[model samples]
Target: MTHKIAILGASGYTGAELVRLIATHPSMEIVALAANSKAGMAYEDVFPHLRHLALPDLVKIEEIDFDNVDLVFCGLPHATSQSVIKALPKSVKVVDLSADFRLRDPEEYVKWYGGQHDALECQAEAVYGLTEFYRDDIKNARLVAGTGCNAATGQYALRPLIEAGVIDLDQIILDLKCAVSGAGRSLKENLLHAELSEGYHPYAIGGTHRHLGEFDQEFSAIAGRPVKVQFTPHLVPANRGILATVYVQGDAQAIYDTLQKTYADETFIQVLPFGKVPSTRHVRGSNFCHIGVSGDRIEGRAIVTAALDNLTKGSSGQALQNANLMLGEEENAGLMLAPCFP
Candidate 1:
């Protein structure tokens, strides 16, 4: 059964990525493309690389006919997706690529996002879209919230260890570097080419990054206690990908074994050979995540690094993967394309 899909914010990078990946999906078709600012323009006009595919012109979200759309990919901004998704037809399964429904608590939503969750009913029903760990939940969920790219990377390195009880709960530290594309296509004074190209610096230091809410929620749940890790995110010069280096107090071999065994049957997660670290270039533009582990100079400590495309596995591709499960289609059907190489 072919599923009809509508991308609610088609002019942005993640939305354009959804179009690019869905263009090859055997069971999905892009029936509607909505971008309020770019409404009425062909998708090709917004993303010239998509010029070859036959696609619909952008429309306003309010104008879409959900009766024909099986799935909706809401790639709007964090605060914007909540209301937009709440208005979508109930029968249409939604994979939101924003932060609207990621945190489970409404109070935490206001604390981190600075406003009350406008769609509390949907918030209660939305499933966190961390594909590997939440596969069963996502498979049956009608509303799935895609993770923050930085959150996804940090979790890849720490989740398995936390779940296995092989790492010290209080000592986890995540030092992550993300490409500019993760910031979205918005223009900002700090994101200017001149300001960003020549140097790299950390922002959201000292556990202030919004994604920490995700890390705290997920890790605390896994450990059956409050597990807060020291997390710092840095903006890098490149355009697409996130690399997280996680420091954990544990035996290196045990950490490696835990991750390898945990993801042994997963398709999109790759556990590299022990001591061999992964690079962002290896997983660029693909849904795959590569994890590598190595022993630290200090005994009882290990460093695990995870790499993935912020736009793909970190956002749109992950949205589609969850959509497939929600629709009962093959999980990796349209996501098997290999990563691009230099």
Candidate 2:
């Protein structure tokens, strides 16, 4: 039986990505599309690149018949998802692509996002959608919370080292360069061409960024201690992709071998040869993560760089992977497209 699907917030970047991937899926059908702002338009009118597909017209969230939608992809903005998901029918499984459900603690949610979490019950039940590490949990979960794209990229580079105790937990640092699309298809003065193009700068420095909550929560859990890593994200002019450079005190070869072995059987993650590195261009527009390891001149230090399309592996693609598990579909169904490289 084909699984019927509904995409909430269908006018945004990640929302359109769901249409792009599901268009080619064999067992999934797009029965509805919802976008509050573009409620009366057709899908093609919102995203011309997706004009080829015969999809449903966009409508308000309330207009969607949840009884018929076997699964839902909530791509709405951050705080919006919590209230929206709370109102969803108990029978409709969901994969949420916002920060609403990623962090498990209500206090942490308040600390980072500010204000109390109105949907406290749902927050505790949502599974962290890291896919490989949380595979078993996701398969049985009712609501899977898609991770922060930056958090996903950084974890791909460092999770193995942290788990294997091969790196100094106290002295790790991550520097990420992300494209503008990760900011979403929103209207912001900073996103204007005159301001963003031909320029690059960093924001959320000094531990103020919210993804640090995920980093701290996940890493600290893995090490059974307070593991803190200095992280800074820089926004670049391109449209998609994230490049995360992590520095740690460990053997370069050990780091490479650990990552290579950890992801050896995983289809979407590729670990480059020792002393080699990857470019964001290598994985753009695809659900693949390329990680490379190199030794620094300082004997005890190593640099690990990981790159992937922020829209794909980081957000929408990640949501679909988790949704597949929730609905008992093939884990990699419709997600194996090759990376777009020039």
TM-score of 1: 0.99
Q: Model 1, 1-342: lDDT tens per residue?
A: 888999998999999899889988998889999999999998888899999999999999889999999999999998899988888879989999999999998988888989889999999999999999999999889999999999999998888899899999989888999999999998899999999998999999777889989998999999999999999999999999999999889999999999999999999999999999999999998999999999999999999999999999999999989998999989997899999997
Candidate 2: deviation at residue 202, Å?
Answer: 0.9
Residues 14-54 of candidate 2 have per-residue lDDT tens digits of 99888888877779999999998999898899899989898
Poorly placed runs, candidate 1 (over 4 Å): none
> Model 2 clash pairs?
none
Off by over 4 Å in 2: none
* Error of model 1, residue 287, in angstroms: 0.6
Clashes of each: 0, 0
> 41 in model 2: Cα distance from truth in Å?
0.5
Determine the backbone clash count of candidate 1: 0
